[model samples]
Target: MSNPAISYAHITRVTDTLVTATEDALAAEEPLEIRLVHNGQQQSITVTMRSPGQDEELAAGFLFTEGIITRYPEIKTIHYNNNVATITLQPGITPALQPAQRNFLANASCGVCGKTDLDAIFAPVKKTITNIKVPAAILHDLPALLRGQQAVFDNTGGLHAAALFDTAGNLLHIREDIGRHNAVDKLIGAALKQELPFSQYGLLLSGRAGFELIQKAAVAGIPVIAAVGAPSSLAVKMAKEWNITLIGFLREGRFNIYHGQEKIAL
Candidate 1:
């Protein structure tokens, strides 16, 4: 069976006066429209271009992380029309929650670019995570753990990844995508599907820790976020505001803690 999330391609390389053509594979991205229905009234909420598999989980995670719906019971059923690549969510029960201050429009390349406003970018959270500390040794070993589970990136080198790990440094879940934010969403979605409590876990990213990534982690009640790459200034600011532990440039047994250092056992 062919996987809709991946595609094969060919590429030509010329190096040192040698030209070679090789067969390769790449991740596929397609428009996925998420439609919401309440009391049988349908409303098209947002359209996102994402890797094709796990449509239902993606939608569930997106809604949950965006603060659109809190409990899984709020979502009745999710269906995808493969013909149009559109997903519809049936809210069987009336949603007592209001629409997000801003809607989301995501692409395969960037996740933070589609937001409508700053307030929406910095949505308020009700709970604050405290007194959770991870050993510095775990920070040093995280990249190796993340690298070992990246089966897709190992094969295609075309996808980013996000992983969740326990305090003991055991990898719980890892998700890959053409976009970094999508990867995080997939991980969050998987966690939500499993009904796992994420308050005690931390997030690890294969790429830079950006503002959107931090926001998503915070929404999911993930207390700590560690990235193998650098973080933007805004990402740091939001982490501080949200009381999230932000770590970046995590490599070579060293890392920088940008905020919420109380959670890091130095």
Candidate 2:
């Protein structure tokens, strides 16, 4: 079964001397409403804009990274319909919803999603096992590996991607979306579905590493995060605080290790 993640549109192309009408491929964007159900009660949790595929995985990943649900088994079943993902929790498992975070909502580029209270946005460090190591040469080849799997982005050039790789630099899984965080969440969700080992894999991002992305990786127990662009000050601070490896500007066999130098074998 396939949910279409790409849409087509007609457009006019204008150049220096020629004008032509053509068809263009666009990464599909749609709003997905996530809901929670337990003890016969259902409530709307958050609504986020995302591409049209992997709705269930996207919801599961969002809940885990947002500190709502810690384990995949906590989710009894995920029912997807009409762009809504409803997660039914297992018996006796109450969602860990904080008052300030309960009303969380975001757009496609929701790094912080209008949440400004650092106290509310930040969670305590997870004490992650940050000692995993990978060769520098292997790290240099990850971006191309990730780029080759971006099926939607290859067509639209409008989506961000996240991929999981083992210590030996083998590509594991990848997910793409218009939002960077959404991409990470989707990848994590897919991994969760298989009960994969999170701490043993590095996460590759198609764009800059943000604070929230680091928080998501930490929550998932992912040890290393490498991004194609730069990282924000808060992102670097959070990475170091969590002792997770963070690499930025990762292309052309060059990268800057903002934190967790020991995680990479130079």
Candidate 3:
């Protein structure tokens, strides 16, 4: 049995003047068409290129985060075949497919943005917690902590990760995918399955913070988002609007705070 998320490829390695032919592991990328079945009618909702594992979670997470369906019960059954994930909705439950989602397509690098449908995305719970007070020490340690758990990334040096951590800095869970957005969806899906509280945990992204990723976090009600890479301008704005903390360039013993100091002590 081989890792479904990894594909083997032949490559040539060059160092200084030496050349060696070798076989290398690559992050797999394949199309996953998410279809919706409701009211006795089925339709392809969106297509995303993603790693091959966790297709079921990816489907549910995509629907929830995309604001197509609210709770997990809206889905009657989820089945995957030939790389197509079909989500059969519970009878009498209608999908809230946004205007753009009907024609959405996402590649492994950037998931099709949901900004256009922001006003219609699922409304997250409104709540408050003031005891988290994360310190600089905890923030600084997150990169190494998350990096250590990236099993496939250790082998392929590819794939993005999304992890959840308690404010005390304890790792909750993590998901990896060729697409960062997909990784987030997978994590959220797992949390949904496990009935974990999203607002109580912090989210970490392995790559730069993009608007769509922020949108996904907001939809899930995640309170803070930290990324090892830079954040887009719109991402910062969204964080501000949501009152969520946004940290970027979060490595090398340093991180920049872009919004929300309520949860950070220093």
Candidate 4:
């Protein structure tokens, strides 16, 4: 299926003495209303501006990662109407019943800006195994691997990507989006659909590691997350709390282990 959220366009640069035209890709950022329904009643919950494609996965992953839905069976169905997306829960499923101590609704550009309280942001992450270990060399080579897979970024230079790799440095899956968090969601959704053992693999992101990204990885049971850029303070803290290995500044055969260094071997 063609994703309506992204497209290619010719960008023209005009100057007094010269004119240049080049093809550029645009990332779509529009409001997606996520509604929840049970029985026959519906409630309009949150609206997020996210890149198109993988709307269903975005919804499912968002809810699951946010503690809205604990099990995959809790989500009955997810439907998207152009820009508006709705999620239907199975009978007796209620995310708000626990009094969602955090407000997750916010702009897609920054996932942690809209939370009203710190506890909401610091909610306990799901448990995961820690037996997996990856070579430090895999982190060194990931940037090139992710770059090779980003066809749209090569053309437009405007998309973010998340890739899953095994301990052997083999690429298992990849997803791209205008918003980094959305890209992670797409990747997770793809893995969930394939019944891939996510907790056994490492996650590589193309952008800086943030709190929301770490939270998503933790919820998905990903034991290790490596980023091509720096990690925020909150991201490091969350990773430590969730027992996840967080690595940053991954380039040129060297990386800094901000938390959980035992998972990466030299």
**Model 1, span 76-189: residue lDDT tens:** 677778613233335355542343433666678766555676555554465555556798887899899889888777767788889999888888988888878788888898
Deviation of model 3 at 196, angstroms = 0.7
lDDT of 3: 0.85
Which run of 10 residues does model 3 get worst, by summed lDDT?
121-130
Clash pairs detected, candidate 1: none
Those runs of model 4 whose alpha carbons end farther than 4 Å from true positions after fitting are 1-3, 8-10, 14-16, 21-23, 96-105
The model with the greater TM-score, 3 or 4, is 3
Per-model TM-score on C-alpha atoms:
0.90, 0.95, 0.91, 0.89
Q: Which candidate ranks first by lDDT, i.e. highest? A: 2
The per-residue C-alpha lDDT of model 3 at residue 116 equals: 52
Best by TM-score: 2
Candidate 3 stretches with Cα past 4 Å from truth are: 113-132
Q: How should the candidates be ordered by lDDT, best one leading?
A: 2, 3, 4, 1
- The ten-residue window of minimal lDDT in model 2 covers 96-105
